[model samples]
Target: MNERSLVFFVIVLLCAGFMALSSFEMVQDYIKPASGRSVILNHLMKLTVALVFFVVFLYTDHRMLFSRPVIVGGYVLSIALLVVVLILPGGETRTHRWMNLGYFSFQPSELVKIYTILFLAWYVEKNQLFMKRLFRGFLKPLLLVSPFLFLILVEPDFSTFALLFLTVMLTLYVAETRGVYVLTFFSIALIFFVYTYRMGMLNNILRSYQIERLVSYLKGNVSEQVMRAVEAIRSGGTVGKGMVLGEEKLFVPVVTSDFILAIVGEELGYIGLGVILFSFYGLVHSLVKVVSRMQPIPSVKTFISGFAILIMLQVMVNVGVVSGIFPVTGVTLPLVSYGGSSLLATMIGFGIVGNMILESERE
Candidate 1:
């Protein structure tokens, strides 16, 4: 690999290493009581899956794969998968976010985020002049996005839907779409949000337990879920409780996924949390640098900026949820969270970013 690719690979490896260590710590604390060897193996298997996907994505030709037809096909496939997920039985706590295949579960909404970015990029590149117009150019992208958004909401995966919406908005803004057009879109979204909530659409779409989780969060009741997360962070204190010493791991729901930040806060403490945040900031900085240097290719630059903002926004939202600054939305902590699909999707996104940087460098 070239120096740039090597640097990108190193960063990805560091992220994976951190997540694996956290997962191991959780397993030792929670699962070891019943079967230590089995717990270790399970965590190792997850780590292996993530690593394998990362390696595969690193070797793939991102530029060729992100072509218009492939991007559109990906969107169609993602929607079909989302439909399949909705039809599948035994989703986590009644949330239709995954399709279980005995050995593993796949979340189609994660893949939707990727295809949305690709499609928007292609759309803006082809309609650069039209993009300067207000409604004809700007609002038209929403027509394509609306169906995906509607499908996600129907699946009752509000958190992912929200993230996806925000990502598209950011992409449009960076693509130089009119600001007033975005404001108008936002107004419409707000109206939809109010209408959905008032008409009990969320309740009809989401499971009762899922609704309860959101209610508990909004009420600040500190449900068993929230308390466990708090205990985990508290245990970390200044330095940390040390790996595998966290008491909260056994009780924290989705400890390896949405709640992974709590484990990191507990095991690595405030300093470790700082380091994690710093690494994310550094990654965003690198993306911005790439954008600045690739001014000649405005389309690519816009895409990179949009992608970076979207990823960083998710990271920030995840941290906020864990820190109690925002209601828990079940959003994974990007690379730090467990799950094969999430890891693979995120790595693919980063690979595309790397490709943009490489293409800029070649020019």
Candidate 2:
């Protein structure tokens, strides 16, 4: 692996360690709603799955993903799962984001995120010459990505949708698609949004809670959950309440998952938050540095850019939500969140990234 990638790997492990320790602290306090062996086993499973994926992708030939059939099949399979996930019960009707596997739930959206990145990178690299064309280049890829996106939005996963949008947009931008096409595309999207609202499509599509969150954000008020997050952050002051000493940890709902950043802020204070943010920043910075320093193929450079942006965007979204900067999103803090699917997906992303560097070194 390249020097930059190796440094990032170390940072990822450190972040994972910090998250694991913090999660255990929550477990001891009984902050999570679930109980018994499930929680413990689930945590163990994330680590186990992460190890397996990272090892395979890191050591093995990364070229498997470049196979067009593999890319197309993976994309199709992920989309199919997204469709199936929607069919599964969410709470009242069917599940939105995950498929229950008895012992633990599997989030197909997580897998889709990685696949989307790979698909765009592969598609862009192959269609580089034709990319500047309007329909053949821009519109076709948009159409291809839209079905998966539509399914995700139908699942009402706004956060994941946001990530997907960024990944595709960054990929196109890196591919040097024309500014006019990008602008026209956004303009058309705005028109589509208006049409959807006019036809009551947006209303039917967006969930009640999602609408509430959006309204709440516009009005500068948030749900009680974020209120608790604000309180937790305030209580931590600077140096933190000292890990397990954080009395406020239990109050914030989903403190072990979505709002875990608040836990870090409250338990370890700004110092801990600094470490978390710094680690993410360093990784993103290193990826950017790698892209700048190393002369890789255009596709590889775009892959690095898109991948780094995905990490940076997710981190910002999660941190921004917990800190009350952005509207609430289901985005997790990557390796720092106690989520098996998210953790595994993140590992897959990094492992592929490392493999890209490995291939470059061989070249």
Candidate 3:
């Protein structure tokens, strides 16, 4: 691989390693299997599936994959999967977001994130002139995104829905859509939020547990979960409790998924967390620099910058939620979360960004 490719690969490896370590802790804490073999097998299964997708993403031609028909077909497939998961029978926790396939359960909402990004990128790239049309220009993109957003919201995956909405808005803004149109959309979103709150529609839309989580945040009631997270960080102190010895892992649910950063903070301490954050910040900075340097290729530049912003935004929101600075939204820390679909989708997105950067360099 070239130097840039090497840098990308190193970053991916670092992320994957962090996630794998977190997953191991979760499995140990939660999954009490009859034998050590079974535990190892489960871990291997998850890691292998993620690795397979990572390889596929690394090899795939992102530009060709972003074509109109391909994008539409991907959206259709993602929605179909979501429907299938909703209809399938499983225990309450598993049934809500996953589809069982003998040995594994997959989350459709995870895949939907990638498909939505692909669709938005393709749409915005093709409609550069619409950026000047104000309200008329936004109609097409809005139409394309509306159904997807509705489906995701119905899935009760509001965190992913928020990410999708942010991605669309960012892509549109970067495409040079008028400020008034952007403001108009934000106004509409605010109005919708108020309507939902006043009508108790928000309560209907979110599950009781979800609503409680929101209430806990709004009321400034630090939940047991948040308290446990805080305790984890405190236990870590300056140097951390030293990996698997950390007590926080035993108390925190979904620590390997949504709140994995807390584990890092608990075991690796603030220094390790700071390193991870700095790496991500550096990645975002490099991406922005790449975009700015590509003045000769405005379309590609806009697309890359918008895409990078979407990724960074999700990261920030997820981190903020975990840190108790924002409402808990079920947003997983990108790259560092132990979900197969998320890992694959993120690799694919970064692959596309890398492709854009490479093309720019070639020019």
Clashing pairs in 3: none
lDDT of 1 by residue, 304-327 (tens): 777788778888888777777777
lDDT of 2 by residue, 1-363 (tens): 346554665566446555545554655646445445555456767778787998788876656787888987998898889989988878773338889988778999888888887788788778888888887678888888888888988888877886888678767867777878887777887798778756767668788777678768868997788889888878988998765666676778887788876777777788877877777777887788777765556667777788888888888888788878888878887777778888888888778877777877788
Predicted structure 2: lDDT:
0.77
Cα lDDT tens digits, model 3, 181-205, are 8788889998998788778788668
- The most accurate candidate by lDDT is 2
Largest TM-score belongs to which candidate? 2
TM-score of each: 0.87, 0.90, 0.86
Q: Candidate 3: lDDT over CA atoms?
A: 0.69
Runs off by more than 4 Å, candidate 1: 1-32, 35-63, 90-92, 199-201
Clashing residue pairs, backbone N/CA/C < 3 A, model 1: none
Q: Which pairs of residues collide in candidate 2?
A: 88-94, 88-95, 89-94, 89-95, 90-94, 90-95
